[model samples]
Target: MSARPTTEAERLRRCRQVFELAVRDRVSMAVARDRLARERWAEADARLSAKNNTALCGTAAPAFAETDEDGDARLQWWQR
Candidate 1:
C-alpha cells in the first residue's frame, strides 16, 4: 500500500512530540535544537508560501470599465 503525504500541521505535531520525547529521554542538546530549528523553518516556509500565493493572485479590478478614474488620475509617460 502507498502512503499519503503529511501536512504541515501533522509534521509540526510530530516535531513537537519528538521534542517532548527527547526531553524525557535526555537526548542530546543538538537533537533538541535541531527539532526546534526544523519547526521554526517549517513555519517560516509556510508563511513565505502564503505570501507568494497572495501576491500572485492579487486583488481583483474592473475588467471592462468604460473609463478608470484612478488610471486617468495617474500621470502618463508623456505627461511625465
Candidate 2:
C-alpha cells in the first residue's frame, strides 16, 4: 500500500505526533528543542491569524479549528 496520508489534516496530526514523540532513543535533546521552537512559532502564527481571519472563523472568532474524525474541537498538537 502507498504510504501517502489520506488527507492533509491527517498528515499534519501524524507529523506532529512524530515530532513530539521524544524522550526515546530515536530523537536527541537538540531535536526536541527544535520541535518545541517550531511549535511555539506556529502558536504565535495561529494567534495572529485568529485575529486576522474573522471571515473564516465567524462567530467562533479566534479560537476556531476543525473537528477531527472523532469530532474534537481541538486536534492540533498545541491544543489541550
Candidate 3:
C-alpha cells in the first residue's frame, strides 16, 4: 500500500481546514448582522417622520453594502 502522509503535512492540512472554517463562520455572522441591521432600519423608517427616515436610511445603506462586500471577499478567499 501507499505510505500515509507525514505528521507535519497532516497537521498543516488540518490547520488549513480550521482556518477555512473560521472564515466561513465569520462571513455567515457578518451577513446575519447586515440582515438584522436592515430589518431594524426598516422598522425605524416605518415609525419615523419623513425627514428623519431619509437620514437614517441613507446612513444604514452603506454599512449594509460594505458588510456584503466583505463577506464576498471572505468566501472567495476560502475557495482558494
Candidate 4:
C-alpha cells in the first residue's frame, strides 16, 4: 500500500488550501470593490452579501461584516 500523508504534510496541505482560498477571495473582493467604486451599488452589495457556507464542508469561521457610510449595518446573504 502507499504511504499515508505525514502530519506535517497534512498541515502544509491545509495551509496551502487556506492560502489559495484567501487569494481567490481577495481577487473577488477587489473586483467587487472596483464595481462599487463605479457606482454599481446593487451588484457590489449582492457580491458582498453573498454567503459562504463553509460549515457544510465542516470548516467554521467568523462571519463577514460590513457597514455603509451612514453607519448602517449591511445584511449578508446568510442574514437574508
Q: What's each prediction's TM-score?
A: 0.36, 0.35, 0.28, 0.26
Q: Model 4 off-target regions past 4 Å? A: 1-6, 27-80
Q: Taking the candidates one at a time, how many backbone clashes does each contain?
A: 0, 0, 0, 0
How well is each residue in 16-50 modelled by candidate 2, as lDDT tens digits? 66566666547975777677669879997887777
Looking at candidate 1, what is the lDDT of residue 41?
95
- TM-score of candidate 2 against the unseen true structure: 0.35
Models sorted by TM-score, best on top: 1, 2, 3, 4
**lDDT (10s digit) by residue, model 4, range 1-80:** 32775688866875565566557666564554454346546766666666764544567676788846553344453366
The order by descending lDDT is: 1, 2, 3, 4
- Among these predictions, the greatest lDDT belongs to 1
Candidate 2 Cα outliers beyond 4 Å, as residue runs: 1-21, 51-80
Among all windows of 10 consecutive residues in model 4, the one with the lowest summed lDDT is 69-78
Write one digit per residue (lDDT tens) for candidate 3, span 1-80: 32775688866875565556557666554565565557768986777856445565566433333336558779899899
**Residue 3 lDDT in model 3?**
75
Candidate with top TM-score is 1
Error of 3 at 43 (Å): 0.2
State the TM-score for model 3. Answer: 0.28
